[model samples]
Target chain A: MMHLLKIEWLKIKNYKAFLFISLFFLIGIFATNYIVYSVFHNIVNKSDAALLLSNFNPYDFEHVWQTVSYTSGYLLMLPSLLLIILVTNEYTFRTNRQNIIDGSSREEYANVKMMMALIVAATSTLFVVLTALAFAYSSEKDFSITGFSHVGYFFLKALSYNIIAIFISTLIKRTGFAIGIFFIYMGAENIIAQFLDVLSMKLKSSKNIDFGSLGDYLPMNSSDGLLSFPPTPLKSFTTSSLPTEYTWIVLGFAIFYLVLFSWLSRRLIIKKDL
Target chain B: MNVLSINNISKNYGKVTALQNVSFSVPRGSVFGILGPNGSGKTTLLGIIMDVLKATGGTYKLFDENPDNQLRKRIGTLLETPNFYHYLSAVQNLKITAGIKQRGENDIERVLEIVSLTNRKNSTFSTYSLGMKQRLAIAAALLGDPEVLVLDEPTNGLDPVGIAEIRELIKLLASQGKTIIMASHMLDEVEKVCSHVAILKYGELITFGNVDEIFINDDIVEVASSNIDQLKDALNLMPGNLKVEIKGNIVQITFPVGSANLENVNQFCFEKGIVLSQLQIRKKSLESKFMELTN
Candidate 1:
């Protein structure tokens, strides 16, 4: 495994585009998150809406962790793009063919990408943790700390997104087309989920039959369900979490999607004629 | 000992069959060449053996062991063209290869020196010429000092000097007791560098054997005299069931393998009062032989 990681590192260590794009996207996510945090903590806290929702605390150490974890999920697409480009470049440059010819097995090659996904996931999650640390301490000097599983869930969400990117890159084998189709897929999954949610709502209102919401089980939404946003003045009208019975179900679906994507990517590389 | 043994191997890309029931073996320390025309399954066969392309049917063994990553590590292969990271320097690209084979990183300098690319080791692959790219590919193949080397069209794109350089390199490696399986469309290259050869046409094996056995000593003796009529008459009287023909002023005689009697033909012509002007023996050219086999 370490040899494979060394191989992947050698491929991209000197690649200027890899360095620039990865840093740009990762820092871009943090920068965007910081700007949004400042707008809410500094400006929104003094508004008329703040009095009505006094219980909601965006600056508390506990709330800051949730705030950062929830908001960082929106920027998962950036790191996912980096993963897509890195994987597809192997095909574009035809190095994958040479790598196998040089003596690495197809499974080892696939594992190299998986390791990179793990590293990318680890790096992005660390950034989120750092952002949480900065915001949590700056907001209050004597604030009490809370649990860290939600941050861990945020890591899984980032991992799921990048693995999905790897699957798209492996299936398509073209950079521009993979990115284009991936965006289309993201939008299409949401649209399909929303349509099903509306259908379930009508079924419940008309017949009093309590069929469950189908949107929470989608590929993208399942991972998004890992962490829910804190109640703010803006989103107080919406429900926060899924039913207690369905939390484990959503988590299981998220895990199933991650494994499914990784397995598919491995199969493509192993069985391909490259 | 055989370095490679392929048995009834076949490959098909959807409807197009690239290789069909091809089988051969390369003996240890021999420079074996796979000769064929364009699209004759040479590269496809090499790709399958190197594990770059999975065969549709049949099996192959390397060093008498089942094919696997560990077995492949003992063989260095360059299929089709020189494939490397264009943006990275040759040193860095070789580092990746060495990492894959799990060899010592110190071997990088030794291979670069062998290919005479040490001066440009730090240069990016994209900046190198076609010949340089080819040499770097050879250098990559030499790392770990494997017992076998598999190269497909190793001299496909090169100047005359580069061709000679690579030919010399292959000969040098062969002298050091390294087995090489090379594929080429250039018959002359194979004729010069290979000790054994296998010819393929449209995915089927036509013939395969040692150079001397396959290219039997069928020497064509061309005798032209001042008196063409007398030369033709004298050639007809020659013994040993030789095929004699007249082309303009020359009497061309093709004797059976290893039966060229130059002295006997000269004496017969002299006694018949036909003063010979040209008596030359030409070895059968590999190009004509290849055309005859492939066609």
Candidate 2:
């Protein structure tokens, strides 16, 4: 596995687009976090900071991990796009065929892409941890490791997004079309999830026919459910706090989607001619 | 032992047949050529053997075992144009290939030197010309020092000098006891480097045999006289003539190898009262041999 990752690293280590996209992802996440942190640093008081900032907290130590993890979720698309470009570039350049001819198996090729996703996810997660720690030290909030589990969820969510992107890229083979489809799927899945949510609500209102949160089981929405902005504004609207049990359920759904996308990508790579 | 064996492989792209029931094998230490014209299923056959393209129906074996990644690792291949990350340098690209082949990185320099690309090893692949790209692809194929090398149109887009360089490199590799399966539409290229050849036309194997055997030395007797029609008639009267034709004032007679010499043809023409003005023996070329087979 490490050998395969090393091979994958060699292919992209000096690639300009890969380097730029990765650096963009790293800086994009940190810069966004910094801008949001600085914008609210002076406006919100300590007591209301938790409510106003919600999950964007760079100051508080107790919930800083969750804050950084939740805030970094917005930047997942950067790495996802990066993965899409990397995979689709192989098709564009026809190096995927060369790779197999040079002796790498289709399974190895697909596994290398999955390893790349893991590495990208790990890198993003590392940034989140580092940003959280730096903010905690600067703010001097009670340094507790209480909400660290959210970091784990953040990593899994990031991996799931990248896996899905890779799956789409492998299936589509064209960079522009793959990315276009990815964005379309991203938009369409949210609409479908919302439609399901609304339908379930209407059925309950009209006939008291209760169907549990089936929309949350969606592939994309399930990962989104893994972490969310603290709902200070929507407390009165509904579901003020995400239950621990619900987070676990979403984690299960996230894992399921991750495996499904990975399996499908492998199947496509192994079965399809480059 | 056979270095590679392809058994009744067939491939179809929807309605277009890319390859139909093609079967051939490369003996160990022999320079084999898959000779064919453009779109003659040479690349398709090589692709199927390398596992880059799937066959519609067939099976192949490498070194007497089913082909897997492990078996493929023992055979280096270059298919079609040189496919590498254009942004990466030759050394970098080769490093990736070495990693894929599970070979030592130190082998990179040796292969680079073998392909004569050591000076430009650090140049990005996009910066290299078509010839350089092809040489670098050969270098990548030589990385692991595999026993077999499968090359598909290695000189397809090269200049005369580039073609000569690749031909020499292939000869050098073959001299080192590497089994080379090269595909080319250029009959002379195959004639120069291939010990054995298989000719394909329209996805069908038309002929397969030893190159020397296939290109037998049929004696070409070029006979001309003051009366060309009389010389032709005299050559026709002669027994054991394979073909007789008149071009301009010369009546060319073809005879089977070792059957007729220049003296015998000259004596026959003189006995028939047609004294030869020009008489020469020319050996038939592989080009003509290929044209005959393909036609």
- Measured over all alpha carbons after superposition, the RMSD of each candidate to the real structure, in angstroms, is 2.8, 3.2
Model 1: DockQ score: 0.75
Every candidate's DockQ is: 0.75, 0.76
Candidate 2 residue-wise lDDT, A189-240, digit = tens: 9899888777767766677665445577899888877785544443545652
Please give the distance, in angstroms, between residue B213's alpha carbon in candidate 2 and its true position after superposition.
1.0
Q: Judged by DockQ cut-offs, is candidate 2 incorrect, acceptable, medium or high?
A: medium
Q: Candidate 2 at residue B229, lDDT?
A: 78
- Residue pairs with backbone overlap in model 1: none
lDDT of 2 by residue, B1-295 (tens): 8888888999999999999998888899999999988899999898888888899998998998889988888888889989999889998998888888888478988888877899999998889987889888888888878889989888866788878988998999899988999999988889899999999999999988798788887878887878877777777888863699998878778888756688877787778887777889888887888889888
A247-274 in candidate 1: lDDT tens per residue?
A: 6787889899999999999999999788
| Cα error of candidate 2 at position A156, Å | 2.5
Pairs of residues at least 3 apart in sequence or in different chains that clash in candidate 2:
none
Give the C-alpha lDDT of model 1: 0.84
lDDT of 1 at A245: 24
